[model samples]
Target: MSTNTVAGVRPAAEPTASQGAAAAFRGAVAAEWTKLFSVPSTWWTMLAGLVVMAASALQLAIYAANDNTNDDPLDDRGIVTVGSVVIDSVELTQYAVLALGLLAITAEFTSGTIRTTLQCTPARGRVLLAKAVVAGAVTFALGLLLGGVGALVARPTLGGWGSAPAAGTIGDIVAVATYLALVGVLALGLGAALRSAVLTITVLFAILMIVPLSLMEPDIAVLNRIADVFPGVAGGHFMAGDTEPYPGAVGLLLLAGWAGAALLLGRAALRRRDA
Candidate 1:
């Protein structure tokens, strides 16, 4: 046997700190961030939310301004613009956010890139988290911008129909933005769990839209009460400051429960499924 070991047969070196699994996750997040913005649909959805909100607010403002009288000029205008327009805008723009959330994951499934995503971030949970984080952040920022701009634009047009929002209006705006982000994250989780955009979207639409309409009956008072705790219902209560049916804090908790349950269920499915 040769006294010296062959150079080519030297012992394998230990993995470097840079090569650790945590580093891989950080890289995955960065790549995911880039991939999220690179998609054209993302920008389109965001723009749609902003435009719809602003346009609705502007229209309400103009209507309020034109209808203003000596007795009711600015204050009345403010109420119509903020109360009616903002509610309508929230309902409409949320659809765009839903689409964005659904596409965030379903597109990967359609394109067969989910496998590649899993390969890079094998934990599966981390992948889900990364998707939620990116989608949630974007939706929240857009919601805040849209809401703020809508409020600002409506301010000038409120001849007497509107009043300036109180000092705590910022808190209300923040709540709306937070709600939007939570809804987006919930949608993303649902998408991942279903892995089919059409099915997920349809289910979401029915839950958010149809159920509430259908349950508006005297005979269904109990059902309506239960449905009031649903995400959409709770969201409406939050935006309008309507605590007749449910207290504000209780409504918020109900919404939080919906979000948390959806997230947990989706995470479990993501972990168990084939990605």
Candidate 2:
């Protein structure tokens, strides 16, 4: 009887060392992280975010020092420290974080590097997960650094009117960090799903900026509620150091929901579309 295998058929090729290297999730994550931090934009954007936060806080401190108000100590402190800067600085910083996050995924698409990335690790979900982890960690660290410095610098300038942030202030700092990180993840997901940086950034800006402003009208209570669920608004509530109609935990959960939904959508897009 003829052999079942074709005459030219050979034994299956052994997995190469490089392919074997990416066997674990941690290895894959490390590889992706190396590529991410190596990009120049990552450093530039991070530096810019830090600078903006510091400058805004400094400006507020100078102004407060000049005015030297004794009214409502916390308000004076917030003014001198937080400065005249609105939560918008934090919101703007989110845009930079978003850009870095989008580039994390879109860079692969733009350079056709994603094929190589996939070849090294065939699981698409893992690739997305790795990107999310790296982006989230970086953004979170930067957020904490920026927020703390901003608060610290402003405190003394405000004539020490503002009491030191309570232990709960740590929670607020953590919330800001979490918000920045989640926004980065959300942008990564959008970039992956859309595979277009401009489109992703535009959509994110609209969702985070325009939507909130438009919904703030008194007639738009329902829309306002919906907009409040976004990371920008939820983050605003946390950084504002005030209670809102919604519980702080609820705001966090809402932000989490946005991040989770975006990630799921990106994953679905990845599975459905060709690289």
Candidate 3:
């Protein structure tokens, strides 16, 4: 027998701490993904969003097509912007997107499954990050679907209205998808911290819709500035490629900042509080 060998075999090396942590995080993400897709409400909410977007697209397209005051549809200086029609449909359907994100985490808490999740993962931050990853991804896809469907449904009527440049239309669709992805992560963060579906949904709705609408007046410079920073308004500016208040890129950064802040808040709560 060789001195360096024992029974012609060697013991396996133990995994490093980093490798162990990585494995745990990956497992957590897989669990979160399974939980999200397995729910019936997830499909229903997404379907509702699709229906709303299609309906809104039809309505907006019809209205745009009926406008005969414009001397030239190609000039489109006074006519409705085709990009706006796509964005408007997305706006009408975004609630379902938010609901999908919120439910991912809140449902776990509501059903007492979060405790089980935490027990399995042990590291709360990993669990929350996993939820964020899964929610953000699914909602990003939802955004793309909604945006594409809306554009296709409206293009037949509004295709000539305004400039309807292919580049601009494509940009708007991408922006819509990006915005919805950030909004989904934001909702997931809020859900993790609040742990109540109803309350989180209500608060998120107010932040995205009610507050922005209430501050819509441009007369007040202060209010206008505040409104411009809200995720909903910022997302609108991004999708429309508006330069007012800030460039579309800046608007995207602002929305991303909001999502980052929410995730940080959720991380703190998850680490400090018991599941």
Candidate 4:
């Protein structure tokens, strides 16, 4: 079978079905990228997140400056964890990305833009995956910038304090970028599944914030154990570099599991439901 014939004939095997499908998937990704940035809200959300990061770093610096009693070795521990301040800013950054992820799909549904989206990309799974990819990429970049600038701005806060964060701690801080991206993907999945901005955002916030609070209030042995492994708690270890029950890898895997499960549920919802 000749792929290219010289005898004025259409190519017998120009591309396989899988190749066509791959091309369609790529097109969906491109469409999602365009749609994501085309809206003004996306830029505003990212800018607000950066502002939060900067303000948070500055706030921590002010607090450190106010601590005028640290002329001892043991006391330096108080300021050496300045990196923790960077991690704190992740909360605001994560929330911003989560909103971006949720709105990426839910806004489409709310404004009835989803119908047009479905018309263009009939494969619902591709649409969802594309949204996830776009959301993940944007958040990863945002998180890196946030983490870097956060550390730089807070470095002065740790001046004349304990030794600098070691290489491993630096790696963990960098891992915060991946953690943020995963959080965004998780929100994107929830958005796809719920298709309502208010409900989706509420549920996400509850999962990330309220559920742990409720679980901790009981203080039961089993409940406390469960709370320790909750996505938010486990995920924090990634950036905070806290190693009590497990290492950073465990934190990353736990958070990644959260994101994977959400995306699967979202895909199922998109496939089973009508737009």
Highest lDDT model number? 3
What TM-score against the true fold does each predicted structure earn? 0.81, 0.80, 0.89, 0.88
Model 1 earns a TM-score of 0.81
Residues 1-275 of candidate 4: C-alpha lDDT, one tens digit per residue = 46566676865667889999999999999999999899999999988888888888778766665563567745433545556777777765678768888999999988999999999999898989889998999888888888778777877765764234667446646777888899899999998999998899899888887898799898897887787777787788766666776786787889999999999999999899886
Q: Choose 1 or 4, whichever is better by lDDT.
A: 4
lDDT of each: 0.76, 0.76, 0.85, 0.81
Candidate 4 displacement at residue 202 in angstroms: 1.3
Ranking by TM-score: 3, 4, 1, 2
lDDT per residue for candidate 1 within 1-275, as digits (tens), equals 34454754765577787677677667777877888899898888888888887887788677766665447545443345354455556776788778877788988999999998888788888787778878788888877887787777777666566666555456656667877887888788888889899998888887777887688655577888877877888888876677679766776777777766777777899888876
Q: Which stretches of candidate 4 lie over 4 Å from their true place?
A: 1-4, 7-12, 65-77, 162-170
Better of 2 and 4 by TM-score: 4
Q: Lowest lDDT 10-mer window, candidate 1?
A: 75-84
Model 2 Cα shift for residue 166 (angstroms): 5.6
lDDT of 1 at 64: 65
Give per-residue CA lDDT, model 3, range 1-275, as digits (tens). 76766999866778999999889888989999898889899999999989998999889888777674467766444456566788987777888899988898888878888888888988888888998999889999888888888887887876556446788777788788898999999998888789898999899989998998888755688888998999888988888788998998999999999899999998998898877
RMSD of each: 5.6, 7.0, 2.8, 2.9
The best candidate by TM-score is: 3
Q: State candidate 4's TM-score.
A: 0.88
